[model samples]
Target: MDITKGYSIAYKGLKNGTHDFAFKVGGALFEAYGSAEIMGGDCDVEVKLDKSETQLVADVTIRGDVVVACDRCLEECRVPVDFEGRLLVKFSDEVREYDGEILWLLPGEDEVDLAQYIYESIVLSLPYQRVHPEGGCDPEMLRRFRIVSDKEFAEIEDRAGAEPDNTAWGKLAELKERMEAGPQDDEK
Candidate 1:
């Protein structure tokens, strides 16, 4: 069965009252959406839908962990997902777009498909900079992708300026010197 089908609610026959719903989100959902950033995850989605004659108010809460590439190490890192928000489902005669806060649907629709909303919420809940905690990343990866420090850049700039010739070989020689001198023994 399609993973997203579990997230749809058949609410046309329901009475005017609040209803609770729960759905499990897994790597399949991400794969279905062809998400490149989210490698995999296990999340729980809880929706409290208050239905009435004209609208449905949904209180959505999502909690789980997603696996993505660490910003620092490029290795798989698990990031926590926690999102709580409200979704107002409003019925209209004309077709309308779903804004972040509200979902607009035609009156004839029998089911509300929440797969897109849940997927986006989980993705959005992730931190802008997803990375393993300090000292948690693989040391080898860290060393491989280490960024140059300000002191190192300044030293290189100073060396380049000190050389009378502003040629490409001058810069290459300086870099070679730094590399051969080793990481800690680069002074002087």
Candidate 2:
């Protein structure tokens, strides 16, 4: 991933303190990481990196809106997104994987590309349903859905009602009634 020059910060030269970085994201940014559900919109990312002697602590906050396809209507709609997370970067001699979140980088690594991570965070923050509010949905699409659902439900109910209720128990009841009457005149 190509890290935007403005988004990268060299922490080695900075004094031990908290530094703030901001980024304005759009469709172009999403394109850098393959095809994304977010087509267009503006999003703001605020990253606060707390530099310490041996470790770097970063608090990332992302907020704004993104255009995504609605699950129900399949129409593009803008959805607000907000996410907050923290990451810890530890300096180490050998490249080692510690769990999943913690990243180990060589002591000499100059800068880190946060673009991919930020992109993933935004995507992960999306809701599973991805639908517009009830009243906000497209009226035409909603009407069509209601019509189809109602028709399907009516068919199911009709089929259920048409089924005969003459179970084995009902047959046994008829048999018992015939026995109580001793035998039919025809049988006699």
Summarize candidate 1's per-residue lDDT along 52-124 as a digit string, tens digits.
9989999999999999999988999999999998999999998888879889999989999999999999988
Candidate 1's TM-score reads 0.76
TM per candidate: 0.76, 0.70
- Among all windows of ten consecutive residues in candidate 1, which has the lowest summed lDDT? 165-174
Off by over 4 Å in 2: 1-6, 97-100, 143-188
Residue pairs in candidate 2 whose N, alpha carbon or C atoms collide under 3 angstroms: none
Clashes found in each candidate (C-alpha, N, C closer than 3 A):
0, 0
- How high a TM-score does candidate 2 get? 0.70
| Model 1: residues with Cα > 4 Å off, grouped in runs | 147-188
Question: Which whole-number lDDT from 0 to 100 does residue 103 have in model 1?
Answer: 97
RMSD (Å) of each candidate, 1 decimal = 10.5, 14.7
